[model samples]
Target: MNATTVSRLTSFAPAAISVLAIEGPRTLEFISKCWQPNQGSSVLPTNRIRFGFTKATDNQPRFGCNESIVVCRTNHERVELHCHGGKQASEKILETLSSLGAMVIPWNQEPCLLARDPIEQEAMEDLVHANSIRSTAILLDQMRGALSRELKRIEQLNANGKLQEAVDCILQLRQRFAIGKHLIHPWSVVLAGPPNVGKSSLLNRMLGYDRAIVHEQAGTTRDSLMERTSFDGWPIDLTDGAGVRLASEASDPIEIAGIDLTLQKAREADCVLLMVDPFSGWTNSHDRIYQETQGKRILVRSKADLQKATSVPPSLLFDAQVETSVMTGEGILELQSAIVAALVPEAPDSGIAIPFRTRHIELLNRLIGL
Candidate 1:
């Protein structure tokens, strides 16, 4: 082949060979010999068609076998074949292509096939095993050019020599992306408080099922019970820990282990929901837990329906409170909305690109610092 033809051959060889393409005046005739209609009347030279074929037996071609093959032609210049989607069939087709002197390439290296942009690629990877609809949507949106647009904008600004403005925009977007990471991935939210504060009930309510057993008995949930759920389009890993309490002789070693685990989880959580029984008011233990939680705390007053009025009073105990009743479902929606608002603050603006990975975040942080 001449150099020009060789380049063309190289460009189209991989995909064409994989699909068993044939190129010659007699290509259609060759295909017709091996092709037998399985679902349609005839295989057209200009359209894609499926059929079946078998080895010749006693001077007769097998009409139909266990599998069907699809054939198509493009503008009379190339013919394509799609065999059964099985290992053996694919191998046989590949062998046939090889015999025809067609070049073969791995599927990933085929450039003629549609390719996803970087953001789209990342989004596809993110959504492959997404745990929530919200996460899926976020990935889909990102894949659909959200990140590309932002990066393009930055590039355009940089090309224009608007260094300060470009840097500012990137910095802001980087911050938003940091928060968006938690939304796209599962975030730990530890439910902790004194014993019998309905932490387990709240956990079950959030999960929309009895994932964690609840009882009137204190310390019924002697260990941490983890349930996965989504809140406000963010994947939340909810953990109902054994209520924080002073260790006693009656406490099982397992229960003590659970408390230790709870404290560990508390330290690692992105947010902490400190449950308090409104009827009993906050105690010293609650204060201790709250102090330990520092500012990563959202005060959730459980059993709100049992109160005289379904409202949080302006007391030190009620400060920054979210009232909730697992039984009556009051304030659940509000609490969820509040949690989302407090956590994410706002949805990322359209065309704003944020890194979705910790590595990206660290790199961006270093970039900013420099």
Candidate 2:
């Protein structure tokens, strides 16, 4: 309990600032060795942020000692260091602290010391991985005890002999868990179709840039290229998979492997954008691919600009169809909307309690069973 502990509270990636927490009996002794305040005393003022630059100690080298930093003594045994977010600055500082007998721990391990409960700790951990603003908002609510308050309400109802009411509340939370589960794990949307179709073009258009290789040649994309993007505030991993064709037509082994990989990604994706054009109209191969995916699908009629007064096929049954021309940027927004609607048909209201973790869902299921 008396040993000093040092942990980085921010992500390891480069940012505007990185936070490091030093706690335990030796916190002040370690802070004094590295940080030199601009004014007043080297002694850190309790709860006040002091501007300083880390200086080299007798035992440590001066490699990253000159970086500007700010320190705040949070409590009797806790001090927060705000330093440059670049890897070198933080790493050197942590190295200095570790060399001075401070225990260096992972950022994730620091949450348990600060969070009041497991739910809040999980929320804090998930916040670092949140890809979209919407997901961050939900995790922020959870961190602020939104889920904890709901659980308490359920407990209160059950204690008062309102068993049915408590069960109903747990059921609602369980239903909301569907959205919570996707907060950290972005939805996977795979673009799949035959060669010469505009699958890659549509993926590039949706990404607002050229990420996948778009070519006139068939099978230009020999492998799956995945790019992460946000549509309507929901994080989506859009995969431009290799063109799926019959084994007899695909002569190369690489293409066959890519085709197999495409089917695998399709099977795992939250939704598959089945692209087809007038030249390569929906065929038996496309049907087989769709059947293999066994998931939500949206038919994309690509290269509409080339379809000059072409007749539409009536036999194709699909959950939804969007006619798009990447050249004209047509139907792109509609496609994005369709994808979001397909993945998240009903979004939970703001401040609603959501079970973001697997344990939360399990607990809710157990409560409902009771």
lDDT of 1 by residue, 272-365 (tens): 8877785556666566566566435678978988874423234434224688999899988887776666667676654446567665556555
List runs of model 2 lying over 4 Å from the truth.
56-58, 61-67, 111-114, 308-317
TM-score of each: 0.70, 0.92
So what's the TM-score on candidate 2?
A: 0.92
What value of lDDT does candidate 2 attain over all alpha carbons? 0.86
Q: Residue 214: error of model 1 in Å?
A: 1.0
Q: RMSD for each model, in Å, please?
A: 7.9, 2.3
lDDT of 2 by residue, 1-370 (tens): 6578899988777699999998888989988888888878887769998999888887786743488989999988899999998988888899999999999998777634565777877898899889898899999899888998999999899889999999988988888887899898989999998988888888888999888888899989988889988999988899987899988888899999999999999999889988878887777668778789867889888888886433435675666888899999889999999998888889778887889999998887777664
Error of 2 at 292 (Å): 1.5
Screening candidate 1 with a backbone cut-off below 3 angstroms (N, C-alpha, C), the clashing residue pairs are: none
